[model samples]
Structure formats: C-alpha cells, structure tokens
Target: MFVGCHVSIRNGYLGAAKTAFAIGANSFQYFPKNPRSMGVKAFDAKDAEACRRFAQERGLVSIGHTSYPTNLAVDEEDMRERTVKHLRNDLEIAEACGSLGVVVHFGHAKGGEPLEGYKRMIRLLDELLHDWRGEAKILLENNAGQGSRMGTTIEELVQVRSLLAAPDRVGFCLDTCHAFASGLWRGSNWKEVAAHMRSSGYFSSLAAVHLNDSVYPSGSFRDRHAPVGRGEIGLEAFSEFLQTPELAEVPIILETPAPAIGGHREEILLVRKLADRQEGVFDLEK
Candidate 1:
C-alpha cells in the first residue's frame, strides 16, 4: 500500500507536497479549497504544474478530498444543484492537480427511503460524468452510518455503483474507523472482511483508504478519529490490515488528528513500516 497522511494546504498545493516529503510520505490527501464553505479560491495554474512535476519526479500520489457539506443525496432542487456545481468544480481542481482520485462522502438520505437516496446519487454522478474527460476518478467514501448517512455497507456502495452501468470513472474509499464504528469488523476477522469485499466484487473498485483509529468503542456510530495505534483500534490490527494482499498499491491516507495530537510523521512512518518490511523498523517510541 502507498502510505501517507492528510497534509495542510494552508501554504498552497505545492507547499502541501513539501510537507508530505518532510513527513517521509510518498502520497498525501488535501482539500483544494475551504472544506466547510461553498466559496473557493482561484487556483494558480503555474503552481499546479509545479506540484504535478514534483509528484512525478518523486513517484508520489495525491488525492483530493471533497468538502464536508457536499451532499449529492439532497432531495431539494437548490441543494442538489449546488451539490452538482461544487462537485464538478472539485473534479476540475483534482484533474488540474493531476490527482489520482477525489474522495467524497456520500451524503445522508434525510429520513427518506434508501432507494431514493441511491437514485439521487446516481443522477448526480451521471451529470458529473456526462461528457466528462478527467484523469482523477471520483471515489465515494464509506460513512460511519450515523443518523441518515448512506454508503456505510459494501452492498449499498456496490448498489450505488451498479446503477451507473460500469462507469470506469467511479470508485470507493473504505474508511477503517467508519467501518469499525459501523461494526463491519472490529479489526479482527480482517481475512473474512477482505474475502467478503472480494466476493461482493467491490474489492477492485477500492481507490483509496482512510486509515484512522476510532476514539469510541465498536458500534458507537460516532465519526471521531484517533491517531493510528492511539485509539481503540490498536497497532496490531493495523499491521494486519496493511499486510492484506487485496489492498496492495492502494493509497492509504491517514485522517488522524493533527501532528501535535498524534504526530502525522510518526503515523506515516508506522504505516510505512507495516507496508514494507524491508524499510527496517525499530520499535515505536512512547
């Protein structure tokens, strides 16, 4: 697996790459603009080119994460229109940056029938991909299944994708903490988990992974993320996850707490060690 962490984009996209390198990461995740607001800052094409060149030179990968409020499952016309506009912008930015994937949270159904939500998602994606030619694939991320959230299960995610009639531009992002909170697997039975995913035919659709530990117990339905090895999901479990053959070469992005609380550098190194035994690991210092 390609191990990395979420890097800040405060210094601009090129600076985000520099921070990733400082942390010993060959991959990273970043939001192109403010994640909470609909407003977006104009991107500098020169800077984007520079960032792309830097990544290519170092054999690095980057992923663009969609904003939190981007709800493609909205029923209202205004909200749905806004969602389409913003996500289309997201796709453009990701393509300009030469990102491999754009990770997005599939929105909640707002207490409506699950089929309705799926249909909404399908229509939104259809519009997004219609006459689209972009290098970055849209990756629908799994949720914690809290409240009216959808795409928590492999079946639901697969179902959503199936409606698209084999769109090559669509994929999935499996969040470890979300899976744990939703009680998919408690970091044990990972082999069975991998087998099930493969059997469901969704394994090949995985484009990225959010490597996080949960702050709460299993089945908490909470989305709080702890640093790797510092929460309920222990290091041993992560070790097993990294060694899973099916996830090979996938971009594993850490969405853990910032470096001050959990240390992004350390977490990236830990995951790297898990992924590559030839890297030579010493014991993790407390």
Candidate 2:
C-alpha cells in the first residue's frame, strides 16, 4: 500500500524523499511553494531529476499540494489571474519532480452564489489547462463545508468535473477529515460512502486519499485535523475505512497534526497496522 504523510521541501525534492524513507513511508505529499505566501523558490533541475530517480528506485509516490492562498472561485480579475499563474508554476514543479499531481482546494464563494463560484472555478481551470502541456494533473480536494466553500459534497465535485473542458486532466483527492466535518460521512458505514462515490462516478476519478481524523464532531464544518485514531473519528472507523476495496491502491497521505517527523512515523506505522489487519497480518492489541 502507498502510505505516507506531508513532508517539507525545504531541503529539496530529493531531501523530501529521503525524509519519507527515514519515516518508513513509501509515499509523501508536499507544497510546491510557500503555502502561506505567493513566493516560489527556484529548484535545480538536476536535483529534481535525481529526486525522481530516487523515488522511482524505491517505489515512492510523491504528490504536490498547491499553496493555500490560491482561490479559483475569486471574482476579482487580478486575483484570479494570480491564482492561475501560481497553479501553472505548481504544475511545472510537479511535472519536474515526477509527482502524481497537485492537490487543490475549491476556493470560497463568499458573497457570490455557489453555482457561480463553481462556474468561475471551471472557467479559470479551463484557462489554466488550455495551452499547458504537462503530465501532472489538477486534483481538487473536498472542503469541510466551512462558510461558502465549494466542493463540500461528492455530487458538487462531480458536477464541477463534468463541466470542466479537460475532465480527464483533472481528478480528486479525498480527505477523511473533510468528509466527516462536511457530514458526508458520519464515521460509520464505509460501504455506504463507497456506494455513494461509485454511483456518483467519483470512484473512477479518485486519485488520492488524505487519511486524516477529524478534530471536531461530525457536521461541525470545521477543518481541524487530528492524528489518526486520536480524535472524534476514532480508530475503529479508520480501520474499517482503510479496508475499503476501492481505496486499496490509492495513495494515502496523512495531513494529521504531528509534533515532529517522529510523530508522523508513528502514525504511518499505525496506519500500516490497521491496513494489515484485513489480512490478519497484525494484531493491534500486541
């Protein structure tokens, strides 16, 4: 199973891969640029190629995450242009580093209609992908239902994809915390969630899974993430969710809170153990 957590790219792409290896991870996610700022650091092509080779040699999966400031649903022309520019840069970096794709948040609607926001997002994305020739895709992430955020529901996400000019170049990244917080899943019945995703055609486009536990109760609409098995979502729910047949081959990325890399390592081991239980390969009690 491909499982890992978010790692820093401060050292470089190869450095990030090494960090994942140190933590017993076969996959990892990273921000292509400063997540809180608009500034992007230039990367050495040699280092990027080396990182790709290293990851390929070790069977590692690396996924890029777009900066948090990008808002595809923005009404302001300049801001929308800047968001597209940043996304283009991110895609370039991801392609260089041999990443699966970049995960993006469906930005907020604020004073605008949600449908309009969805259309705006689609239009902006069409502009972004129009002339771009890159192997990395754009993976939209589900929101936690906070305020006017788009993509809070699987149906809405599916609709957005249907409207996109290049639906084949765009996909999805599912976050367990967002699913619980948005009331899409109540920490029960993985089969039901899987069934819904299958019927909505979301399963076919699924690219990755953000394996997080929610810090708050279901339907809270909060985006707080907690370490696996240590929050409201609980361990039992996670174990069952890990065993879902549809998700078996999907890369699982941990966005859970961690004090340090060591904490992430522990969580990675725990997740592996949970997944292994399906084959009676490990006992949690031990």
What are the lDDT figures for the candidates, one per model?
0.82, 0.87
| Residue-wise C-alpha lDDT for candidate 2, range 1-286, written one tens digit per residue | 8999999989988999999988899999998878997555676888888888999999999999998877779888988888888888888889998998999987678685898898789889999998878889999999999878567888888999989888988989999999999989998867798899999999899999999988899999999998887788887788888988888888999998876546588788889888866454334333
Candidate that scores best on lDDT: 2
Pairs in clash, predicted candidate 1: none
lDDT of 1 by residue, 1-286 (tens): 5788888788888888888887788889999788897655578877877888888888788999988878778899887777777777777878877788788887678885777888888988888787678788889888897877577888888878888843788998899999988888688777888888999988888988999999988778899999887888877788888888877888899998877654587778778776665334425423
List TM-score per model, in order.
Answer: 0.93, 0.95
* Full-model lDDT, candidate 1: 0.82
Best by TM-score: 2
Give the Cα error of residue 193 in candidate 1, in Å: 0.9
Quote the lDDT for 182 in model 2. 91
Model 2 misplacement above 4 A: 278-286
Residue 12, candidate 1: C-alpha displacement in angstroms:
1.3
